[model samples]
Target chain A: MVLAFKNETFRDDFTFSNSPAAIRRFPFPFVEDKYMYSVNIEPHELGPKGSVYEFPIDIDEHYVSEMRDRALVLDADPGRCQALPHMITAQWDMLELLMTSMARDYPEHFSLTRDGNQWHWINRPLGIDHKFTFGDVATLPYQPMEYIGRQCQGDFSIQDQRDGQLWMDAGIITTQADWSLDFDVGMNFFEWHAPVPLAHQAGVFDRALKFLLNMQHGRPVRRLNWTMTINSRLDTSPENYHKWGIDRTTVTPENVGDKVHLRVELQALWRLPRSNAILFSIRCYMIKMRELATVPKWGRRLPRVLRTLPDEIADYKGLTRYRQTTIDWLSKYDDGAPTSLGGGPD
Target chain B: MSTIKSRPIYPGLSPDPNARRNVVVCDAAGAEAVVELLARADGEFAGRTSVVLSSEGLFGKESESIVERLKPATVETTAGLVPAIDRLKEILASATMGLRLYAAGSEPLIGSVVQAGAENFIDPLSVRTEHRGSLKRRVQCVHCKGMTENVTTNPVKCAQCGLLLLVRDHYSKRLAAFQGVCINAETPDESPELKVEFQ
Candidate 1:
């Protein structure tokens, strides 16, 4: 059957539409001309609300399209989503957490009917009504987390909290912004983020780790991170570097405006009530430079940040090749708009 | 997109600047000239908030009817005579500050315009709309996933497939339309109900 609304067409048509939903919900990251990375984490409620992933688990307009993309990614690379054999409890915890969250947020479309050990979960959006007993893997067709993740829009991973640190152990991640789930699995929280520049030297990671460790069960924390991509491709992981990596260098100056995309990942970390595992959800969004330029301030600020950005950070971000050209294109709309252009003493 | 950037810019903390709040409204009849209206405000328009009003176009008119009426001047006023969506997009991309967008029109018109801003990541707080026109909707057929604009009936005919569809409250933001499910989905031989006024 033909899908009702294919995402590619929707994006192509809406990207240029003034005030299209895609441009409005886009999280423009640069606030000033000078650029630097720090522990930018914040409480989930404090950040701009209702733009993305409002609840612990959010189902948005892109839910169906993203889910379809995930399925394709999984089919192409089984290594994209995996759960260690010993992490079954965490998987079950995530499954329950996701179900309850969905049922609470979209009650009309999702419901969880429970009677003691037996429970019935209905996903109206997916048209799936499942009945299973709690804690019984056999009752479900697939692993609890995997089964639930198949329908989720965000990539999820669980970290076991112990020994004064959280260990990255289990997850179902098909759409990673950059890092690899297979490579980072089993690495401690700090180690997983080790590749991220400046966070460690600046003590941002230590402070964030402490904050994450002390996170209360009911409270969830989230933060927004952003970068630029060469194209609209969502699967920007290194695993398929050959597929998209070449585009980075080959894109000419004329097409750079339309080809370059701003990628923002909204990452939320939750302290699962039981099993003491932290569920991290990452949802990615991309808007090209031409569309992003519509936001006058965004168009202006982005280039200044890039032009003044140090080479190290630029290299780290894979922006070294096109940073200048991207800056030139964004500068067309800049008109020397008022901005903070120089870096301050750290 | 993953990049490792290493630049020791200002090593220290800097105060985060507040984004300039902008207001843009789109409707069948765009609001009055923004500059003149702001000139009449208690104080001057000191560039704190940029305002642009994109109203629907008038057929056979050489100049935008609203722009001609307002004859607005200054950076704060734009008599956007083209499709509000096109003008709004142009306004949104050029600003250097954060924006707050407002739309006033029919449900379908407002929803479609708002969906554009939502897609661009405009903060929900920064965006609001007052429904000012008809109660009709823009429906999307679930069976064919095609959008039918300006629908007025509950059991509307799907423009794409000619199927009788019962419109549901479920609005898909992606399609920016209420789902119109096939009325005879379960019963293949039964004649579907013809028409009913939408709420």
Candidate 2:
């Protein structure tokens, strides 16, 4: 979990080695050679076996490192962390929710005490114990969400429900999965997902929006979204595409397995109690094709999925150029093995 | 000549070095291989200390004698592999470079334990897994994100959210579970049979 970095900075020199631990835990998304978008939401619960999503605010080994990385990203670009004028109250709501969740889930590190409107927060991990009035901006150094966001691992956004739809109003997103909040702010739910194909035609987005609108304040829904990235870098927004996009093109057939990574975003949506705004959080995870191959069935399924992926979807995922090469590389794992497709190895 | 009943074992990955310190994790189904796994480890990793974790209720009673003979530190988990993994996290934190992890269980158990080891910075090269148990699917409800275990019915009820889920053939490696959509998705009230098999 904690790697010895070359320096005490989030620099390019940071190299990652594939560990057995990572391979076993890697969420292999491809059930078949092709993937599709669906409202794959599930309720959060503790299984007979422990699950990662058992708690609302999950504090894992990546907690400290991710928080540090967020700080570094925010320090470089304050724009990455923003709260709209209308979302001020929602920000405070989010701050309280996160604090309470963390305090409950991780008692050793976080604690929250309230005396009416005045609140006391102690974050042992970050070494901060402070007292602040609930609604007073001057009581905190930064915006309410950003202050708490700095302590949490995932990037967050708060969408206000008004005029019969949800608005993309407020968030602290330093690590985005391709989309930018700068352009998305103030846009309605459908407008925000305007680029996602078939959802509109099939009425999936409308149905989903309505379901979110009706979601109870206390209850939350979570879903998973996936994409492929060229490297392990977290900053892959369009603004930085020139930096990472080039790597996608440069990946050779022999190295594609090691270079390409499956980036999965575990997104959760919660309806805030007071403001009626939805708190959306995204946590990104990456695992390479070679590492994925360690899981026998997963190794067999991906190549077929790539071969059958629709052109439009493949282009949307930016898998146009390297799809064939990646498939060829994955073919090495088949070894005449049976796939879910039920045929002799291709 | 009489024939011996032969059931194929799940082809699990093996650790080459097998190291001096071992942590063996297993569930009920994987209990069959515990003796062989331990013997192999003992041969390669002589004089090493071990901590073995077994899923609740399923740890083999017959294996208990061999386990007692090895004098290995043991933990039995009732709340799935997550609790066992939480314990493993502490042991791995202080673990030395030569420590090797062996997992023998269902896919979810192995996956969860592997994730825990990975979180502790264990190299994949030092970890071996022998998948045992049923192919019965673990399905996650799309409505609630809660997972229902050992589901055989196509339209299975989600244990967490109480939704009638149609377990899709598509599996999610991240959750180490399959996607289960509402059976009555289009026609909210009129439930329809999935009439499809899990691939």
TM-score of each candidate structure, all chains considered together: 0.58, 0.58
Off by over 4 Å in 2: A1-11, A14-19, A31-33, A47-50, A335-346, B1-199
lDDT of 1 by residue, A166-273 (tens): 877888887676666765565576656755666667888778889989988878888777777776766776555435555677567798777888777788888887
lDDT of 2 at B158: 82
**Tens-digit lDDT track of model 2 for B44-146:** 4434545455546544664565456444434344445667677778788888877778778776676566657756766433467787765566776654667
User: What does fnat come to for each candidate?
Assistant: 0.00, 0.00
Task: State the local distance difference test value for candidate 2.
Answer: 0.68
Q: What would the TM-score be for candidate 2 when compared with the true structure?
A: 0.58
lDDT of 2 by residue, A81-161 (tens): 767687999999999999999898778888999999899999887789999999998999898998999998778999999
Report the error of model 2 at residue B74, Å.
Answer: 90
Clashes of each: 50, 20
Evaluate residue A239 in candidate 1 and report its C-alpha lDDT on the 0 to 100 scale: 52
Query: Residue B21 in model 1: shift from native, Å?
Result: 72
Residue B160, model 1, lDDT = 85
True contacts kept of 1: 0.00
